[model samples]
Target: MTSRALLRFSSCESLNFPSTMQHAAVISCVFISSLLHTGQFALIETKETVWAAVGDQASLSCRLTEDKDVLQITWQKVLPNGEKNLATYTKKFGSRVSAGLEEKMDFQYESLQSCSMVIRKVMEEDEGCYRCLFNTYPNGALIGWTCLKLYVLPTELHGPFITISRSNSPPGSVVTCSATGRPVPMVTLTVLHQNLSFSHYNTSRVSNTNGTVTSTTTALLSALSSTQVECSVLVQTAAFRELLVTVPGLTDSSDGLDEDFESDDKDERWLVTVAMGLLVVFLCGAFGVLSMLWFKKKHQNR
Candidate 1:
């Protein structure tokens, strides 16, 4: 072959080699790009709903599908008015200037591709929708949204009550016990006297129409001495909630010792009455014997 023709054929072969390889490479690139775009779109479309209680920690998470193109990911809070931004990622947006954002609010960025917003000491106002935005090259963008709900619960139960009063009898005692709590409570009262068994009393009442039931008890003790008396109030609420309160007993000084003194005086009076009656009988018998002896002597002299 001629040298010029050989050179031209070699050039043609070189051009064809590249042309054939270009189509395959372009097809492969298109397939990969399609897969990556689809995955990114899925990540943006599917978001999880997060819930947390007040005064607890919460996290908002977002991941990128195309790691190489991920430039920055941001998290922002959208206000209820829809026209203002409540808070924004401060690391990427300069220092945070939001009126409500405080130093305790934590914002964490991962490898410049993922974002996790950690909120400490969450409050009711913190409950709202949060947006996740991803910045990428080649006009690619991904956005995810999540909703957070915060709930506040009550901390503790209410109270148990006790009251005491005297009965109609002079120096007698009466006691009343009660307790109040959420969902109502069962109450029991126990009265204790020294050298005596415990006396128990119980009663219940439903004060509210919301099925809240309250219980009460009343008790009385007689002949009470200057002794320590104990009045106990036991309360039980729904779900085994329990509370106990004890009241010191009332001491009756006059009634307790006076009864014993009166009994002793009556026994002494009875003994004195019997002794006088026996003396009268003996005197009468002596007078009768003397009269009979005088009559017998008069008859003998006649």
Candidate 2:
């Protein structure tokens, strides 16, 4: 073979080699450029917030400003001593970290772009700071933190039991009723006679160191007979309080017994009057018989 022909063949082989490697080199360069762009976009895009209510569901959101495909998103709770991973979202494994979260914390993941964590039923322990972390390919990682506070309110008030006692003497009697409640209670007492209004009293008492209050009221009755009395107690607090009303019929010591004794005395007096009348009638009949006999004997002697 000629030297020029041999050189030409070598040049053709070199040109073919360059042509074969061009497509692969272009693909590599494009892929690297895409990776760099994705990294930069991810670095600028990660931001999130966490919101929760006591005794309700809570959510942590990881929102991306960039429209690029996300690699992985993670949610974590910041405890006093350490951090606890709640949920994770990934593109390849689709949510590989969710199993760990479900097993440990029972948290559920929503989506890839969203590291949104759905906490089952929120509680006092669930309240704290949380972090949303995003791990992107070329861009390293991004972290967003949010602090949450939870408050729970009270439900209802319990009770106040009232008791009444009578102590003292006279035509009028003194009666007292006492009650207790959580917060300070307002007490009102009303006395009635045969459906007629007699007297009304109102008073309030507060608890000192202990969380209890007692109220008392006194009233004088007009007569020593059966009377209907109504007592009402009202308690007020921050959330709510309770109101209790009671009506009680009271009996006097002298009413029924005195009436019965008087009736018995009247019955004895009537019996004595009947006996005197019978004695008078019997004496009159005897005197009449004696006079008739004496007059008849005198006529016969004459």
Candidate 3:
């Protein structure tokens, strides 16, 4: 109904009430009528922030507080430069996604009063704020905003490559271990064998363009009594990788001597094989010469 007609009706109703009650009754009627006319009760509810890991699906939803005859709901992504419409849902048209975002974004749930959008295989570029616009008759549009944050956690830990360099000063070996992961993984060194002594040398970090960090740590080993050292690469308490390395000069001297003796034995066997081969060749030649001589004597006797 028209505002003027409603006000007239409120005045007529208020005439039956007492002075103090009439004012309150009229005010209530006018407020209720105004709310009905403006459709201001159509508010949307949504989460403030949604977080998801990269390559995972991120779902964003919006629901109207009060039921309304909504025509359509448009989902938009808020960018630093401007906002871009990603998808839309309507009863008549169903769901439609933007051209480039068709593979990445789509409507998960479609309704006039409530809707949700899903981003498949979420990437770093997909991290941003989004808004859902509810289009209603007479009310224009109601908007609700939600922001997305993408996190990249190390999934499969690769390696803790260890390299050793012998140092003359103080008579120790310098051990270096490195690993690459997202969010800067931590590298640590420990001596696994007993009687092994080591001290911290230094650590360095490098950032890559692909959003990964390489961490390297160096340590000085004091004693040669221990042979085994370990390197641990960790992103957090949840994810970790470990590698074991053998110190070159710290192994038993007997093992080296045995290896050398084995090598010498192999060389002796090879020399024997060559010598036997030569003896076979000489014997074959002698047999051929003796056969030729016997055949010549038989021919001369014939």
Candidate 4:
């Protein structure tokens, strides 16, 4: 072991042994794990993935091992294209957190031993891999990595989008409800009245040109005396949105109206056919009389 390591290990024996012993034990484990790196020694405990919902807060914490004099702590984010420097904090310079992220992060314990950050109102862009680094005096640097996944909640999930139209052929109604969200929401349909039943249904999901997803559900109702139905959407982020569709006629049914229009067209065609037959008979009688008159005048001349 180097002199710094020997001094650090011996100092724990002189100080509060219980608390200092914990640091020594963690430091010894890190040193053994880094036989290739020699003097660089630091370890932190945290999860590899953090799941959060849009418009909600998330936290990433890191606790260093046997770190007394921490020079700087840095947080970085890795995206598909490249890496972005998120924030940085130094004991002497205070904090140099990013512009928009200043109000979103909490830097209460900005030191070398413990570096923690809070993400406020997580958004879709926040989903990515994050790296936390601690630069200490003789130990060099310690790094810990984590990833974030942010889910979007359903939006504008209300109003005429939820509708019920009366069934013309059958003695029931067809109910359709559509909701939009990211991470594709899971939609469920339920009739309000106790005795109502769902005979059959169809559901489809479409990916918009934008980043959002739209889900539409159609439910066939039989013996449905219910005045309303409910559509509940659940997102991956544990956030949910719900809307109720009053069975009150949202669409009109025009079944058999086209047959009435066809009947009227047939009656008009029959009237035109009868009028043409009468005109043809009148023209034939007039031509026969004129021929008779001409023949009589020729015989008189002879």
Candidate 5:
């Protein structure tokens, strides 16, 4: 039927514009309504949201219902600013997919029935929303939107630097283990050899400038035995980093002895510097005295 007749029979209204413009709007609206009623003109059916991991592949697909005349299919990545066209498939022109970006996507089209796109090695930059558009004649465009949420898996979990040193806070030694990892890795200090374990440790967390996290866990050991200590760090159960440290007990006298040696070394350096200065002054004075005596003797002889 003609668009003007369809508008009238469907009771669709528009502004007092040109008959052509009004008819077009009413036709598009009425066509959408009829599609909803019969579920035919709505050709694109896809997932509302999709999730993937970094360095992994994601499958995005859509199938056409009874509507079989799909002229074009375009895939776009939506950002905060605007949408970026990733790839396009046309029945007449085949596919003119991009090489650099298109290498990441494996897009396949089955004429007017179905199409699928795979995102290879999905990255953090690929985490966003996507839009799939199907071009259909007479009815315009049918679209489906899906959000892609990516989990950036953690890597390189390193360093729970375990150190055993003397402390006077509780009149014993202090053991501090600090580590840094991405996605807030779990860090713990344990005595591996003796099966001594403690879960409570002082944690200092810092949000890094590069959108990562740094966690330093300090565990104070007071009067603990000399054993093999281990610093364990990981991102969930995915990655792990462990270091073994042989901890030795400390006495208060050892700390005092270290301080005393440092102080004595400084004092010796200072005394040497002062002694050299005094020797220079003494030599200058002796030279002056000899010059005066020689001058006086010369005057007396003259």
Candidate 6:
């Protein structure tokens, strides 16, 4: 009975040994695979989009999440034609720029693990996407893409000039808001009075020689009982300026026109008064000189 019990226990141990070996083999393979991938691959951290004003400096950078055996780092500018190599950094050679790109851009920070470059004077031609490539061993090249956007901001924004005219047939006020800025600013018109309603139409844009744009938007005002309106001007996402103008009543259109004419009349009258006073001063000086000359001649004759 003891021999039979021992034999049964031995068979049970033999049956479980193969199962244990299979489990150990699987765990070992998983561990080795994780190690290989962790050593071979790297994560690149970078900004997706960077913005800079024209004639300003722009910085582009990238970093590695894990330590990589980076053989070389290449910075490429994406163009409409093709990808052009701008600069490169290596562990052995330090940093080097391409033949023609030395003055345009330079390496801000350089290392095997992280790198950055700055464009000294950004221009419209320099606006495009850039790529940072990590040439790593065994994993080939790990690439990170970033784009640079260039803009020409207006130095001085022109007036959001508001003008009102009478529409004879519709019997309402025709309001126009205009502004000038770089990159074509957006113009918005709002009527402040609750009883007033307006419909916008005919937005026109004109490009200037100095790389600026003039935008004019016209709206038809109906039931205009209010005396005020708002105008907003925006360039890209930035709020450039805002203006408030007086809206003459629909029935009071003639009043607004008359007021403008009256203002012009006042200006003309002031100019005429200045001219008349200057002429009188000249005539009085001439008369006094002639009388003095006549008296001197009589004295000399005596």
Question: Which candidate achieves the best lDDT against the true structure?
Answer: 3
User: Residue 205 error for model 4, in Å?
Assistant: 2.4
TM-score for predicted model 1 compared with the true structure: 0.36
Model 1 lDDT, residue 154, Cα? 28
Task: Write candidate 5's Cα lDDT for 1-302 as tens digits.
Answer: 54545655356574565889878877777776665634532456778778776789998887776665678888888888988888888867887666687688877877656777789998888888888878878666677777787765785455767776666666454567777667787777776654554333677888777666777777755434566677888765457888888665454446567889999999999999999999999999999999999999999999
lDDT of 4 by residue, 32-142 (tens): 545633434336666788888778998887777664567888888887786677788886788788888788776656456777778888888777888887877776667
Each model's RMSD to truth, in Å? 22.2, 24.8, 15.7, 14.6, 17.5, 16.1
Query: How does each model score on TM-score?
Result: 0.36, 0.35, 0.44, 0.43, 0.43, 0.60
lDDT of 5 at 160: 68
Ranking by lDDT: 3, 6, 5, 4, 1, 2
Model 1 worst lDDT run, 10 consecutive residues: 233-242
Error of 6 at 278 (Å): 33
- What tens digits encode model 1's per-residue C-alpha lDDT throughout 140-167? 5576778787654323334456665665
Better of 3 and 4 by lDDT: 3
lDDT of 6 by residue, 150-236 (tens): 776667578788887778777777889999887788998887877665775668999999978899989887664557878889886
Which digits, one per residue and each the tens of the lDDT, describe model 3 over residues 216-242? 999888664547889998876447889
**What order do you get sorting by TM-score, best first?**
6, 3, 5, 4, 1, 2
| Candidate 6 vs. true structure, TM-score | 0.60
- For model 4, the local distance difference test gives 0.71
Show where candidate 6 strays beyond 4 Å. Answer: 1-42, 181-184, 190-198, 207-213, 223-228, 235-239, 246-302
lDDT of 2 at 73: 73
Q: Candidate 4 has what TM-score?
A: 0.43
Q: Alpha carbon lDDT of residue 276, candidate 2?
A: 99
In model 4, the Cα lDDT at residue 172 comes to 67
Model 1: runs farther than 4 Å from truth?
A: 1-41, 44-47, 83-100, 156-302
